[model samples]
Target: MSTSPLPRPSDLIARRRAEVAALLATDAAQAALAIHGTPLLLLDTARVEQQFRRLRDALPFVRFHYAVKALDHPAALAVLDRAGCGFDVATSEELALLVDGSVDTARIIHTHPIKKPAEIEHALAVGVRTFVVDNDAELAKFSRAPRDVRLLVRLAYRNPHAKSDLSSKFGVGFHEAERLVREARRRGIRVGGFSFHVGSQLDDPDRFVHAVDETIAFMSRLERQLSVRFDTLDIGGGFPVGYDRDVAGIEDIASGIRPSLERVRGRYTILAEPGRILVAEAATLVTSVMGIAERADGRWYYLDDGVYGAYSNVVAEDVHPLVFAVTELDGDAEQATHRWATLAGPTCDSADVIAREMLLPDLRVGDPLASPAMGAYTAVTSTRFNGRPLTSIAVLSQAPATGEVAIPAATSGVGGPQPQTVP
Candidate 1:
């Protein structure tokens, strides 16, 4: 047997640039594109659709909802909308964004572990029935929602392999899912199903299966006890995507879980809220190195988009963001350290550090720095901490069949041309 050759990172990136160019060539978006912008995001809409389709085909029984919090760019949302995927939102702000973008209200699922009254009210008013509740207070809040809402009890994904401690932060424990389900039944609201998130950059593919199995067993026990069947089982997003070599590939994760999910075909409505997996590798954050400072001990690279605006995750979560030279740079050890070095943003605050002790090739002012896998939790979590304006954004499209990526000259926003068919 023979297999197809895998695509190299460079090859994949080049293909993405071409897709963007083709999208920009269309007369519709040419004039709207900003000729000059510092930091930008390039989205691969085609790749997203391809990934969604592949998931759908492989797990025909499951429903894949694109977590809009990943990349809410209008164009990207449009792609998911057309691909027949629903949107998952954590807040009313996100819900409004999708609704304003013309997303079908019927397809939206309001699923924040911690829901405020306004968010709950708006979700109810906006026809967002699907929700995930963890505690009694949240259940009480949902029970009193202005409209009838469908509830999916969130379960704890306590897999030790998960990078983030999401199990501790969100979801009712596996032992507690039944109680929540019963509470929903008692409230007279429809209990749609259950959900669980396995955390970010999950290296273990079986983690998903583990979560599903745990959810199913719990749901089954509850059904037998309460004599009620669940209508849905949301495997709340955490489909892994390779951001580095150490991370597992999409195929590995998908292949590992397909068999497990297939066994539960008739049990419940299988849905997913995939955020990082869907858009993590599809976009890059382009930032310019404003200046470089050298100390006797080390050197620092200052960027236009700092921890305040673009790299909020660094400070908020203390995550050492992956940084790369957008263009190439040439220098030596005293200048460039393979080991981690502290990188800060250009702001008055002393705590505005992007990545402390991050590995890099070299440093220079005015050089473009590219951060991959930034499509998720980067721009959407951005803040005008120092009144910095949001950087302009561009969307990229890829032909999955050919592994070709294009860099479309983006107009003001997501108003790009209808995608061109690949031969």
Candidate 2:
């Protein structure tokens, strides 16, 4: 029997383009443009909820915690909270977003391996009971906590292939992990389980499986040697999101690691922190050409938003999100008219280029351009460098009955430069 072939990268790109086109054609999107105009992010809460449900369905036995560091937008948090998903926070500010949203503290986990004593106290004061640690000093910081507090030792499984090798910064190897766990026990701290992140934007499914299997084996061996029984295993979020290409879907990665998790399902609580995969496709960025110039290299188009704004993912995450001109989406621009142009961001810094050698139609000043799969690590990682205000986010799917787009108060840039409508 023959099976249907998987989609090619081009096919995936085409699908994304179609989806973005459909989204831009919506009344909500148009209304957003008419109001907030370019340099805007259209956040679809429905897409966030849908991605959360997909993760749950694919790995039904594992509990998912949305990584708040990916996108701290209130609407995305509200959608995931309403969908009964837990949260994983790395900083107190991220936790504050959840606290302000009135999210249940019991469903939240503080996964930052290193934290200040004051931060720990704040989290504990806010009713967060679970925390993760990778070093003896961090474990010692938790020693004075209440008896009900639980800790998870973070193990590092390095994946050089990942866009970000998270292990390089945070996470412990086998020997250090063993030492931390033992030290936690000696200090009378209850080490409930272990946690690990393979890496961020990792496309290798086997890497996930290997990490899971290795962590489980280590847990079992340590339990036997130390005579301790653990109750939880946190597979920290590093699930990949396809940007300008096809990558392993959540189901594919889940399938590879499910069997390993299934073996210990009854004995342990399996938890996953998913950030990128859940929100990457939930937002689309719309930018406008601020100026056009012919540089020594080639024709250059400067956009209102770039690496320091919504396209910060380009530099921070090392991923290329595809950009399309609005005219191309409307099917008004012909392929023959397209040319390779360098796209630059609206910043005084010469390094503010968004993309180089980009094939785009002859765009003029004020021509609108858009990029999809921008929900994760985009706005959250954005900065106000060169006195440029943060790009405004317009909530698309959760608009009121009157068809008005809702821009979150936190991101509205109330006293900053007002968003100008595209002419």
Candidate 3:
């Protein structure tokens, strides 16, 4: 059967450029950019907290564990921490980041399906009891652990369309999942339940319903066949966040997920790992045009930050961030003319190119370009390629400040955005 193709970016996408433009023209953003210069990320802690509240309101019954891998920024996590949100950590550093923040370990769950013995021990030692495992070797690592540690078998459901096909690298098929549970039983390890990531940035909400229903059935069948009851079902993170175009709304997804989850209520503890949806819109990347060049093909405007920097999301996830010129935001929409330009990063590598055929205003040296929805994997996955310094992040107020804004203290190496004065 032929399926309908996704609408073009312009048609389905929200008019986010105006939002980013207005934000950049704000007195606070301007002052911050003026002081810190370009390659800055403007993060709104309030945005993170708001997103958390939105998810909670949508799926009131499901317990949310903010995926630390999405954006490990301490300030961002602290916002969620204060919002009474739980956490999902995957590595020693991620766990340490939370523990260092003095967050309650009881509220955190380690969800990496495979880990080195040392990593497992590290998380276990730090009061993380709930873990994910998909194979014999992973189950064997927990053999020596305390009986309290509960393991969740990672089940694989391949969806090639997901930004990241997590099933290929992680999770196990049904037979392997059943075998893992049996082995865990043989080794006297407690099996809590099962976990599977449908995929990341999924636009389809019905897929969630299908997966949840399938999982609930599989668990019930396993209980009858293996004489074991699963107590928890982790509907791992796959919630979509809009970037280049609009995807399914969180409420729309919850509508589909809520009914299915109602079937398992009172019997199973429902958990969801939300990474991109919560943090993707909490920040925006601001980069300055370093130089304007005319190559043989066309005009190339080199920006200070590129694929190896804050634009990593573009390269890694194929998420096209809508770029807006600061000039347009300042009510200068009537530029000399608009033309297609090749946006390149400061990196020397050819692959560092950000976008091609970008219809932009005639840009000059030092013109600022802003990309919204940059709060997720962009900064977290960024590299220090070409020895460029990390971009400074500026934390802004929920509402426009009348005067000098307050700067949050640096929580960690990935510091909070410094405050920028509005007046």
TM-scores for all candidates: the values are 0.80, 0.93, 0.92
Q: How many residue pairs in model 2 have overlapping backbones? A: 0
Worst 10 residues of 2 by lDDT: 414-423
Q: Clash pairs of candidate 3?
A: 393-417, 395-417
**lDDT per residue, candidate 2, 75-176, as tens digits?**
788889989999999999889889988999999999999899999999999999999998878988988899999999888888999999889988888888
Q: The CA-based lDDT of model 2 is what?
A: 0.86
Residue 131 accuracy (lDDT) in model 1: 85
Q: Which whole-number lDDT from 0 to 100 does residue 169 have in model 2?
A: 88
Rank the models by TM-score, top first. Answer: 2, 3, 1
Number of the top candidate by TM-score?
2
Candidates' RMSD to native? 7.2, 5.5, 4.7
lDDT of model 3 at position 207? 77
The clash numbers for all candidates, in the given order, read 20, 0, 2
TM-score, prediction 2: 0.93
Pairs of residues at least 3 apart in sequence or in different chains that clash in candidate 2: none
Residue-level lDDT of model 1, residues 128-208, one tens digit each, is 878888888888886666445678877777766665657888877756777777776788767778888888657677777
